[model samples]
Target: MEKPFSDYWKEYLNIQNAPCGQVGDTNEDTLNLLKNSDVVCSVRFEYRNCRTRIPVLMKMEDGYKAIYPHLSAYPKESEAQLMKINIQIAQSAGVHITSNEIIYLNKEYIRKDYLDLNEFLLRSDHLFNRRNKPSKTIDECMEQYDFDLDEWIDTVQTLLDSPEFTLDRSKKCTTGRRCSYYDDCFDESKLPDDSILFLTTSSHKLQAYANGIRRISDLEPEDIEGFKLQYAQYMASKHGIFYDKVALKIWTSMIQYPISYLDFEWDTFAIPPYENMKAFDVLCFQYSLHIEDVNHNLSHHDFFDTADCREKFILSLLETIPKKGSILVYNMEGAEKLRLKQLGEQFPKYKEQLDQICDRMIDLSKPFECGLFYDNRMRGHYSLKKVLPVFTDEYSYHQLSIQNGLNAVFTYRTFDSALPEQKQVIRQELSNYCKMDTFAEYVIFHGLEKYLKEDDVNA
Candidate 1:
């Protein structure tokens, strides 16, 4: 920023202009650029140590307008604070700030919201770290800033004045996931393998950790809100597994003949690509179905398409799934069943047929999700990927080119630009991945059936 109109900066931002007279170190390049251009993308500025990044700066007749693009469904409070703080930064930098708008590119739709800094809900006016607070890291201290100059100065002085150093394990909990320095910073290896700190519930884990409850064994029934998955996890930590044979039997009994294990892989577009699709609607482009008859003959059925797949996807599914049997889907509420419902809504003509299929659909995950079946090997998680290994190690996502749904979606996204050979390979990998998913459901289903039959024989 010291060298205004620097070609490197312009090139980095991908907005290069030819021969703009820019005075060095005088903030003249920004003025020159604004004078010539209607809009500037990603105008960067630093004020009061906190970073101010404006995505779009439009030269308006009145003054200037800042447009911040928010990609998520809901903007976080901290994000809003950072956005509003830009107005203060622009004022400091002598850019006449008139209005700020947030252009939401959310999953629902594109929306523009005018931000009134007068309300200033994100206003901050201080420096001293709260007694309970972990002192700001080096990066935080150096980059701290405020709308109020006095408060910004206080932030600097407070950092210089020295603050209490509190070690926050929770910070390590998440930062460790991605940060390489985490291993050196915290020795979580000291904690038990089944540490209560690893509980999925954040509030509960933090509370228990604060109370010095270290291991999973230390947690009692009273600690959890109610019985179910958490209780299964707690008990399994001691016993290594939990199998309510009776409950599992009941779940297994619900299955009719010629059971079909269903799985869907779909791409979610922020903007609706198809006519009937709403924003964030998933286009069901691929499916894998495994049907097992009474005689134990297994057949595989699948469909995949890159373009205009909505109608074909529905028709293929209806044709593939047998008319007279149970349709078993893992995570019915979220995945396969939901896809069916959406397809039905999108194609009203096929709603009756889709509903018929939906009626036959049964969630195969009921036993594991409800804690009727659990294995410590699952590590307190019940996703098909997590649950698959307990039943058999013969199959694994690691062995496949496309390991998960997201990978399949990402690969399909590149299909349009792919070379002919690449296209064929991509198509095959996509099919294999989806096939594996339905097969995984079958593996689990078969395991359950075998478990029930063996239990009955022993009884």
Candidate 2:
């Protein structure tokens, strides 16, 4: 549905809330409307047999500026580079544009980003057409975009007339992401815990898998680079389990009289829900902390709210968390510690207090991640849920309505829109989920300590 230039300009000024319109396949409609409005929604451009619709065509006082809006907070480097290619491609098709820019929707409301396409030219790959030799300018590269219309038509015809579809396992595979047909292609359950394909941080695992190196035991020393964790995985497969007692002992010894097992559940907004928030900024709505004293006595503390909970959340934590103990969190850098630091940064008054909390915080994942402990059931994954199941079936997230952090946040996001009864149910589910996280932390922390005391050599 194409709209008049007035509607598009009103949308730019936020004067009217209009439904997102579409770009017509016909070029003349867009071409005529481009100048009448301050902002044009989509301008269709055709180059060779290939075509694309530039998301936004802003009418500058001089000429025109092309804008490509990215839905994600920060788009991939390739995608950003592709935006420049698209503009150059448009220029090649005689849609002369003075400048081009990429807009992150969540950010563009207030923030202005200036992009230098020249800085990206050397690395930009062909968007629609491949070239045998590299081109010096973006325009030069786009000029070489010659799509074989007949070749594509012929390929489509052959596929349509094909009698049977056959699977070819011999073809090179992309294991970077698991697609819908992944399970049908590879029986992941049959792979051993220490399969060469599961080698930690190795990009060439597909090459190893293709060469018939199924298990880590089958891999020769020269086949893989000697990464610290990779060797630990290899040794774990051979020696039954990998237990770096010295490292475990050092880590365990860091725990003080009172230990706080902390877990946080936060919501990330594409648009700023509150003041002083950047795009995709986290708003911590809930947290669970389980403090265990020297006597092994456990005390649980938690915070939850539907509105701006930052101030109250920190106040509750500062008061609840013991002054002198190692605060345990699954991934300190990524989660709890980062949250605390951000909170301190956001609220400067609490900077000292939050910094103190961060100083005491320790990542409980060190043992498993640093190769101090390993179990075959872990399956090369060290997430709280994955690692928790390895210790005992007594605790499982499968029993909960809200199983993961993502689920909890998603449920939380809908709380305002939900009916009263639905809101109550959501609250209960989120509370239970957050409570379970800290409790799981408590269980896992003790489980590690017990494993150490029970070990004859380590004890």
Candidate 3:
């Protein structure tokens, strides 16, 4: 059986004073054993330009020799200068040096295997040694001080004291990517006990709530009017907090709709995965649609889990969805329309059909994105995952094994690897998560509709 990397590293360290190139090896016996091996060969040389030492690997070929430079080889000129410097070092050490500065004089030696390791370790002794070595970078320092269970528990307890430690309130975190604890340090339960985020009125906007305003009804009507009615910065002096019930009436009227609630999951690419493809194509992988009927009842349609199957998926979606509905989506430009255009290019045969979907796409998110509907829970960010929790007692994906699209993609990709029984559970979980997304959209639409109808009655 092969040893794990840790075991191999420990064993390597036990060897004493092995050779010029073998790191962690301290024994001369181990060095001789390595030298006698037919499959491996190594040598050490000093470079003068930077006063660096490097190891080269040598391997045996049919009747000739080949040299593998260390991974740490510097600029071409630096290597040349170092080779010259190595010869001078060897001469000073009372070793006979050839014109080509061949020490140990292995005429037929070749280099192979562990070339990168040889270069990394042999060229710079600073990493494993302290002499002439600079301290590691912050990232490297983090690796060095790997925390244990006790240390982790202490840190978690410390974060629990701060309200800003919660996932939604992360903007208040002082360290921007600079802290070593960025990934491992966070406490989800540290959100304020009485959050003002649920309030619908504009006085409890994200900023107002942050400034210690916790309820919609508490603010004077002027505060709501300045922000909601005139879309003015109500917090500013003179312009002040003004709430106009008349303007609020008109603002709420735009909420009427043959509302189509939409959601999509997509695959983003670093490199184009296909010909004529650009980086960052939102390859639409799944979508959910929930529409309110003329009778005011809601109906839903959804697509999920495919690969190289996007073309047929788009065609089916175009046929199934209505052309002239108020297509409401949490983040329309980002999720629905962006993917539609990308798929359109791939299936030019249905370009007109796809464009039609884009034209009727009315974003439910516009009110939020334009700051018309601000929630303190969102902490200045408008994500449906955050917004969905404001109205209903339900969370969009609380029960699912995978919480968001990233986790969804990762789960979908590995679904086939599991045994049949395990796969069944995962498949059910994925379906449940996606279904909840559309259902949450339905809830938001209903809430908005109710708000509008009440405003119409008051008007």
Q: How do these models rank on lDDT, best leading?
A: 1, 2, 3
lDDT tens readout by residue for model 1, 343-397: 8888899999998998999988888888888777776568889889989999998
Model 3 poorest 10 in a row by lDDT: 101-110
Off by over 4 Å in 2: 1-39, 43-52, 58-64, 71-77, 80-99, 104-187, 222-224, 457-459
Better lDDT candidate (1, 3): 1
RMSD in Å for all candidates = 9.2, 6.8, 14.5
TM-score of 3: 0.52
> Of the candidates numbered 2 and 3, which has the greater TM-score value?
2
Residues 1-459, candidate 3, lDDT per residue (tens digit)? Answer: 023322222233332233334544333433354356422224332322122232322223431121223212121222334443443443343323332211111112222332122211222211211332333322233234433434544676678666774444333433334345544564424544223343333333567666777544445555655433123222211232222334444554554456667777776643234443443455666777777776788777777655556776786687667766567666778677888887777678887888887887767665555555443444434577876776577565776777887898777767667888988887777777777787887776566556556666997
Better of 2 and 3 by lDDT: 2
Q: What lDDT score belongs to each candidate, Candidate 1 first?
A: 0.70, 0.70, 0.51
Error in Å for residue 168 of model 2: 8.5
Which pairs of residues collide in model 2?
A: none
Return the TM-score for each candidate structure. Answer: 0.76, 0.77, 0.52
